[model samples]
Target: MTFESHGVSAGCWTGTLQSDRRPASLSVTHRGAVVVQAALREAGPGVWAVSAGLPPSVIDNGVHSLLLVVGDSVLASLTLVAGTVAGDDLLAEVAQLRAELDLLKREFRRLATGG
Candidate 1:
């Protein structure tokens, strides 16, 4: 079985799942817990349309990872970043990364302009 993500919209994640056999049970998990479960409907031969709602309880000021799973197998993942979830540590790390990136960009521009 293989799955192709169509991306998330309106707080729902969607994708096309292809399987030679019958469609399996689909569940959306977050933080090691099942958040949503939906039946996969046949879209075409060997194709299934998968959609699951992103639970509002999972939304908060932090990074959340949503997993599309069938049984024990994780087929896909979607990451959502909201406000400050990791506190100052993440902010500091991001600041450091941005500073390094700015330096790299400056160096790249200098080399490109032959300055």
Candidate 2:
């Protein structure tokens, strides 16, 4: 079995699961949290699209163990690293970079015009 870490958003995440066995059901459970039933859709043979929602408070920037259960057995167990869950820091950094780029553009224009 193979899985992809799709990052996190609003205490939820969407990822893809691939296995040789046709999945009957899908669910995710985080440590000390309730089991979240994932909404699964088959994308192709042995490929399942999944989305799981975690508890809001449980999404703080940290690593969490997420167990993927399919049918009556545990299919895959993995760790989800939550970084900038809301992406506030990332957005702020992007905005800062944009501002710096704008300043650099203005400086270049002034230099080229010799003004």
Candidate 3:
């Protein structure tokens, strides 16, 4: 995940990017824990980005989390922000898995028939 900004802060994980620039303040939480926090900065307009380098284990298990706070107030918060599992990459992986399953099924059928 890659986040770029001139003043805003963003959080990225699992191929999904979550950003908040309402007041130029942003916070990121993972598994109900705060991971990243960035203060607002004036950069002419408003531009900022945050990227989270998620480990393979996290992705394989399919987990996500997010949290935002503004002056002791919860502006936005979400848990399990799972993106499209049928996306291009996931689709390709699913296709491969299906093909393998098909092959195994064919082999099993053949063995059963022979027996």
Candidate 4:
């Protein structure tokens, strides 16, 4: 299996899977726990574009595995890093606060100037 994107963002991952033999089903897991059942779309002959979403319970930032299964056998396994860094999440919060502060500043200035 070849992945177009190696990272998971917004709880989802998109990639491509190539195989001579198509699997009956595909699934994703984190720390040996099943997280999502993935669906595949044929992009070309013997190639598929796959997308899967992470389960809400697996919230920690770390590496997770995707298991490609054909019947009872695991065809292949892929790894990915999960969750956003603390700094990134904090940056988003800071941007939101800045917007709110700007609005408050505008309101205060209007009141003080009586305009």
Candidate 3 local lDDT, 1-115, one digit each (tens): 1233222223233222233343444465545456666444333333433334333333343334344544444444444424555456555655765896699789889999995
Provide the global lDDT of candidate 3 against the true structure: 0.45
lDDT of all the models against the reference? 0.81, 0.70, 0.45, 0.66
lDDT of 1 by residue, 1-115 (tens): 8889988798888999999876457899987899999567889999999888888987766766677998887788787778756667567646855896699799889999999
Q: Which stretches of candidate 4 lie over 4 Å from their true place?
A: 1-6, 61-115
Go through the candidates in order and give the C-alpha RMSD of each one to the true structure: 10.3, 14.9, 16.4, 17.3
Expressed as tens digits, the lDDT of each residue in 1-115 for candidate 4 is: 4445445678776677787756677887655566778878888988887778866666556544456554455555555445665666656655855896699799889999999
- Please state the error at residue 3 of candidate 3 in Å: 16
**Candidate 2, residues 17-64: lDDT per residue as tens digits?**
887775666777665345678887788999878788876655557555
RMSD versus native structure for model 3? 16.4
Q: Give the TM-score of candidate 2.
A: 0.50
State the lDDT at 48 in candidate 3: 37
TM-score, predicted candidate 1 vs. hidden true structure: 0.70
Pick by lDDT: which candidate is best? 1
Residue 35's lDDT within candidate 2 is 69
TM-score of each: 0.70, 0.50, 0.31, 0.51
Ranking by lDDT: 1, 2, 4, 3
